[model samples]
Target: MEVYSEKQQIRAAIDALKSKNLTLGLVPTMGALHDGHLQLVKKALANNDKVVVSVFVNPTQFDNNEDLVKYPRTLEKDIALLKTVSRNDILVYTPTIEDIYEGNTVSENFDFDGLEFEMEGKFRHGHFDGVGTIVKRFFEIVKPHQAYFGEKDFQQLAIIKKLVEKHDIPITIVGCKIHREANGLAMSSRNTRLKPEYKKAAPFIFKTLKTAKELFGTKSANKIIEWVEKQFANHDLLELEYIIIADTETLKPVKRKSNQKSYRAFIAVYADDIRLIDNIALN
Candidate 1:
């Protein structure tokens, strides 16, 4: 496994691989390697000749300074975790903020076809712009044949696909399944900040999502939404942020379920200070 912090050297290495006709896969991540992240690496390795996993906590992506500061940065442990599943050709790029952004850390404004108008976009404000800028930068830097992203951030996955389409980037954006703990809590870097009791109650979020899925066809979207809200309202530790049943493609909230249209139940919750989000497909 080769680790690099310099962009030029990494690009040179990638050029060498390309010369040999190697198919490269990229997994862009903000480091705090859990089994969920390793799963993405494994998926990349299974499909490509070589894989590059980036471990930089992008400042542009964080809307809140406190959230950015509190975000986990376990690069040493991240590298060790990667080593467990990493092959010889796996390149871990640990670039500094200066390396990624040069002198400026500001995000580029992007039009995600109004896909950024709801949910996180409404809440965080300019959050997707930052995500778009950093992701676009990663695509330019890596120039990989395929890039992998976990579907836990369902809306963000949609935005990224749109990003590639709008730019006409010749790269496959692969969406992997949302990985979860044995207890059903969706795996997130923020999970590290979860307190002991909150962690114990966190699995309730997934349970609520499951129930909402079960109620999809029989109950109205609004009914399911109401039920999910009520479930969290009674919980002692978890506080519901937003829960919506929306079409999978357009991401518009659906009042009535259509047989022809696919839908998903998306939920955001706060286990005290830690904000976690999860979604389940409802067909």
Candidate 2:
């Protein structure tokens, strides 16, 4: 329940916890709490003795300024939900733009170049670099034994793992499952932005991806993408961003192979102005 805006105070508190030899876990978030974020908390709490959930909205991560401006922030309700989840010993850090970036500061560059410009990377240029920088800073400040991320953002999970290894951040990256809603749409705070009609129609993205999963063994990559594209094409509310079949680990497009190396189906769609991302690992 204790909130620490100052880095020194937060570190001091972490130091006190470390003195007792309790395990430290960090769950970095952007405030707006949902079942997906809670799933991460549950995983972290189960693994470590002391769980610190960070609630800072890093401006650098958003490729679109309007999207950044519209990103939700509901700290009071979020904290109340955290308490209900039995996560009271949280070290919430909410930093000002100046606190994160000082006086027109030049940020350090991370070499995610090739990895940066593909799929969502191609869609959101320099987005992962922004994610890398903020996450690196969090790792340094919290010095947690482990950091948790949700697998819904499978690509982000992959990037952060590499970032930790490349930078020698000394923290283990743990990924929890992709949480979902009753209708099968991936639970996201942005789901709140969708209109009632669009919300019901939104689950079609998951259905399309799931249908692609069902057709994986029988169909080729191009066939699968086309089928998924057609499904979304008919839905007026849903605007297809990128639909691709790729190797789950590499995120490279999957070629038509009879061997079946377990491809992944990922789709990013915009229902009206609200963007929602979801994916399914082909069986």
Candidate 3:
């Protein structure tokens, strides 16, 4: 695997690949590579002729400056992890903030058709705008045939889809399944920040989602949310942010089951200061 921290060098490399008529797959990530990120890389390798994994902990995406400061950056370790996944022609684009922004940095205002008005959108103000800005820049730079993202950030996936459609970008946005630990906690870069005890209790988030899914057919959305709240009531370390049952496409809160549309349970919990998010499909 070859690593490039300069934008021009990476662009030239991608251009060389394009000359060979090779399809490029992209897995954009903020470093601190974990099993979850490896899953995306593996998928990219399986489908595309060549894969480019971009690792830049985008400062624009963080709503909290402290969260941005606290975000993990392990480029050396990340490169090592990428090497384990593929010994083939893989390019790791780790660009500097100045290289990506080029001094004319501006926040993106996206109309996600009300997709960003609740849950994560409501909680983290201008969070999706930051996400849109950075992702749009990556799309422009990488120009890959396809890009992969995990369904762990379901709403973010939806917003990216909207971004692609709105821009008429010719790239397939692939949403991979959420990769989880053996204990069922969704793997996240922020998981590294969790305290030892809070780490042990982290699986409770997924456990609650499982229970909420099981109750979907029999209980109303509000009731299921109430039940999830009560389940976490005894766990002092895991503070609930939001437990929402919403339409899979619209992301608006679902009042009842729909025969035509799918519903999903999305949850955000503050395990001490480390925020964790997870979602499960409701059948």
Candidate 4:
């Protein structure tokens, strides 16, 4: 695997590959490599002739400075993990912040067509705008034929699909399945930061979602949400943030059963101060 910290060098390398008629795939990520991220790389390797994995902790995306500062950055270990996942020739782009945002970096406002108004968008202000800016930059720089993103960030995946359509970028956006631990917790880089005791209780987030799914057909959305909140209420280690049943497409909160469209349960929880998010289909 070859690693390039400069954009120009990576662009030149990709250009060289394109000269040989190779199709390129991109898997953009923040640097703390985990099994979830490797799954994305595995899919990219299977589909494209060449794959480029970007490992930059984008500062623009973080609304909280502390979260940004505390976000994991094990570049050496991350590269080592990537090496284990793919023996095929791979390019790792690890650009510096200045390399990505050379001059005045203004966060561009994105109209996600009402997709950004609830859940993550409502909670973290300007989070998706920052997501949009960096992703757009990467698309421009990498110019891959296909890009892979994990479904773990379900809402983000939807917004990115909108971003691609809004710009008319000539690339296919592929959403891969969410990778989870044996215990049912969605695999995330932030899982590494959880305290040992909190880690053990973390899987309850998914457990609760599963229960919510089972109760969907019989119970009202309000009733199901109430039960989910009550399940987390007594747990001192787990604090429920928000839980809602919403249409899968519009992401608008659903109050009643709809025969026309599918719905899902979206959730966010703070397990001992470490925030984790998960969602499950309720159809």
The number of the candidate with the highest lDDT is 1
- Residue range with the least summed lDDT across 10 consecutive positions in model 2: 104-113
Q: Which parts of model 4 have CA positions greater than 4 angstroms off?
A: none
What overall lDDT goes with each candidate model? 0.92, 0.83, 0.91, 0.91
The residue-by-residue lDDT of candidate 4 on 221-252, one tens digit each, is 99999999999998879999899888989999
Candidate 1 overall lDDT versus native: 0.92
Clashing pairs in model 4, backbone N/Cα/C closer than 3 A: none
Q: After superposition, how far is residue 82 of candidate 2 from its true place, in Å?
A: 0.7
Positional deviation of 239 in candidate 1, in angstroms? Answer: 0.6
Taking the tens digit of each residue's C-alpha lDDT, what string does model 1 give over 1-283? 7999989989999999999999999999999989999999999999999999999888888889999999999988998898899648699999998998999989999998988987778788889999999899989999999999999998999999999999999999999999999999999999999999999999999998998888986889988888888888888889999998888888889966779999988889998999999999999
Worst 10 residues of 3 by lDDT: 103-112
Candidate 3, 151-217: lDDT as tens digits: 9999999999999998999999999999999999999999999889999999989988998888888
Question: Whole-model lDDT, candidate 4?
Answer: 0.91
**Which residue pairs clash within candidate 2?**
none
Off by over 4 Å in 3: none
Whichever of 2 and 4 has more lDDT, that candidate is 4
